[model samples]
Target: MTLKDFLKPDKQANLEVFSVSPRLIPVNKSINFNLYINSSAREGVDRFVCIWKAGKAIQENDVSEIAKKFGHIYIAENQRNHFFKDLGDNKNLATKEKVEILKNAALDHLDQLFHNTDDMIQSESIKKCLVECEAAAIGLMESIRNYDLFGLHDLIAELDFHDHYTLDHSINTGLYNMMLFREINPNATNEQLKIAGLSGMFHDIGKIKLPNSIINATQDLEPEEYIKIKQHPIWGRDLLQQEGIKFQRNHLNIIKNVVYEHHENYDGSGYPNGLKAEEINIFARMTSISDFFDAITTKRSYHTPLEPLDALGVIENTCGIKVDPYLFERFKRKILKDEKLDSALYLPKDFDPCCPHTALDLMYEDEIQKSELNENDQEDVIHYHWAKKTQLPKIS
Candidate 1:
């Protein structure tokens, strides 16, 4: 299935709840998490039967045997924390494995949030979601914190353009914002990264509430249209709050303020409130820098995408106008420091749905099509799936 199809809430009435990458599961060891392959079902529904139970020894060949027929895996949504925690505790996990796990999890979580936050509000699923979000976000932060300013350069490799722009952009913005937070504060705590990462993620959530027909009716927006666009921050802020639900007040305040004020520009020239200079929140200011960078680099309907270096120059011109000048400087140096690591690593989503994409699919199209079962070649196909099913390694 397409990532969009995999993420759709309308499809959730079936057995599958969440997806995971096979790369996230360890080889030659009994995993703490369960893994599933789909059971044949009614055409439109997915009923998953666990193929690998938790604590069972998983031989490398056993995973391949399951993967040969059903190319993907599923995990329960509630097991997200356990999955991440296991990844963190596995001292032997490779850097590449960690990168794949983080990239896939980020995209999945952000996509679900974008699509289901509305349902969360209507049904009061907000509290449960927030707890899950915090655990997932913090786990990601802890796993990558030792990498310094480079959160995950291989994750940058998947920053290639795609139709699923909103969700992809949000994931990039959160990772970039988290890295920038560390650059600004070298000893940033997991709590600090959680606020920085999630605020950047939901910063533009307000835009989703507006109708696309109204948003794209003209080349130049009407004054009313402008106001509607500007109000996303307010909607985003309000969306995080639920009546009678006890949230961590301070943490919620930082997250809400960033979403509410990220659109407010640096000098005296932003929207909604137009409060100038230091009046704009710091986390919001940091997000503006990351948000602007990702927006310009990625393909958008109104404009062509720019190269990262070229995008940096474009961001340079808007230093004081669109984003904070000081924070932009920090973000720039961080990008340059890690530039060589991702020199030619970007792969489009369609080609590499599972992240930590090593481009094996493009190189081995023929071999993959006609290859016979061989123990030596089994590990090769694990990077990208040929068919679809729920198998995010049973979110544990």
Candidate 2:
């Protein structure tokens, strides 16, 4: 079934009167139900005093005092040990294990949020997701510092084949952007890296506002439908602006720019104002390349997935036209040199290596040859040429 089929209509049902428990007796007394008696009452003003009173009461209670009032006993007192002994054991976990734990937690939280998007408050959900993204970014930076690229790639690729396109694409884009940003500026601060990571993760938040019909379409879009699709960037930017008030000014700006300009091409051929070259925000420019790479490599309703090498070639070929040429070249070199992805070209276990040639294979024939040549050339032709021309720091 299509995604549209999964979304039930927004139904507003009245709260049914169920049997009330003794525990709810006091709680009901504390709340002023009279405030909600009027059906036309706006929650903001009508419930303000009631909510404030409840919040004030909560703030006045000390944790230990509340526990005592609730007749709870501390096991530590009877056992002659600390109450939270198990919590400290995590400190002994290896750094790699810690990073993996953090990465998995982040992805799980994101998956939950995406699945419950219709039921949760959007602003609150986005805020929590950003916090998780920042934590994951910090862990990722630590992993990169230790040169644990293989483990990192495996963790990311584990989520690569999931059926949820938007969630998987957001996560992979964030990861690819983080890696590329670190390579481009190895000396960048953790805060800067986190911003890049967060930008990539939320760049497509606007798509959440699009009709599922367009988003999940298996066929090509009509001209009007494509126009609606193009408006996603604008919607994303506005949504972030409205909900990101708590973010630091600079971080929020980075997010807004990335969402707004991620689709704009380097050659002024893109939509929502055809920003060209440096006119596009730098974070947006970086995210654009990563976004394109993830989009083409991931399977979607409209197209078959392309192999990593072939995907890179498509990005390389579109350099200066769709993406920043300089950035694309750097990103390409990094992927080709990454030892972690050495087996990236190998077909998955279910695939037949000798299967009939597909359209992608034919289109990427020349690019595939270049990759093979780079692999087999004793002189290291690609590296030699890159070193001779580019001003990049030497790849270790």
Candidate 3:
């Protein structure tokens, strides 16, 4: 059964509910459970929480308290620790074990990405974080591409914008890297795909040097503020050189170009260095297309995210001027050729579905309703008339 089926409410429910274990059941169907905790003062709950314990029943409220204290809240039936342990330790089940490791790793990485904040970094710390993030992104890509790993869709669905621009950009870039990688070579080796994925994750690592105010700006800034933003590419190149990533000049050039030239224009009107057309690195050119696509499609602090088709239209409008003509053509062809890939570009209603996006959807719906109401108001006014001879009823 699917995850949606698993979350279905149980019938024959009891008010005096106790925890049930699904491991005891045979492999007949997928098991699902949801935790409910009472936090009302009259109900006398010190804390509202629930959790799963392997091979044991929750006897005391203290157990619940312990779970809550340790932050053991939601537990998935299929995500039991034993599953990971069994998958990790078994040699005969190498492929299955690898898939499990990769999936869990991806989920764990994403969890850190979504939940963690206030740990922003710039120099050495930023370097470490980028390395780990790249490792995870590349590893996940190789796992999914090679083994067709399970649980990826669910994991990807859980991605949200809680970790700020760095986190969101990392995940988005990694995802897009996988997309482009698959488009170019679905059967690529693990190493081949891994490097490409790493490139995606670290594409913007250089932007760490930018002033926080500019990076997190909510509205359009003055001309001077905009000029400072353009200096980020030079800052990025210097950062990479200091980090000693050790690659061919071409690869470094491409990556740095992406960092530097992502905002560059096709008609020779970008920033930092505005080398036109053939002068732009191919990787950066590819990134320019993907980065803008995600930027426009992703919900930002100041702008509503566009739908995929609308986003595509934006890309089309900028073609030959703002974006690489050849890359745009390639992107369009890929979208047209693959329905699934095209769908991936569009945000799914149930996926992520973060607070910001949920709020946007609600606001959009309300606006539509108000517009309809206004139209109806006009109709009512047009259809109504007051007669001077009308008589009023008297009440005694």
Clashes of each: 12, 0, 0
Quote each prediction's TM-score: 0.61, 0.58, 0.52
Indicate the worst ten consecutive residues by lDDT in candidate 2.
79-88
Residues 263-378, candidate 3: write the lDDT tens digits. Answer: 56665666667777767765666666666666656766666766656666555545555566556655556655653222212221111111122223222323333554686545
Better of 1 and 3 by lDDT: 1
Task: Please give the TM-score that candidate 3 achieves against the real structure.
Answer: 0.52
How would you encode candidate 2's per-residue C-alpha lDDT over 291-353 as one tens digit per residue? 776765655654576666665655555556666767766655664565332122322111211
Q: How accurate is candidate 1 locally (lDDT)?
A: 0.60
lDDT of 2: 0.54
Per TM-score, the best of the predicted structures is 1
How many clashes in candidate 2? Answer: 0
lDDT of 3: 0.47
Cα lDDT tens digits for candidate 1, 1-396: 222222122222355346666665667766776776666557865767666667866665666656766777776665666677566555567645564465555666555555663534541444554555565566566566665433354456554433456666766677777877988777777778888887766677666576654433425556686667667777777777757546688987888888888777665566668866568888988888777667655555655555666556545544555566666666566657645321222222122111111122222334543433666556444322321221212211
Give per-residue lDDT, candidate 1, residue 291.
Answer: 78
RMSD of each: 18.5, 14.8, 20.1
Candidate 3, residue 258: lDDT: 65
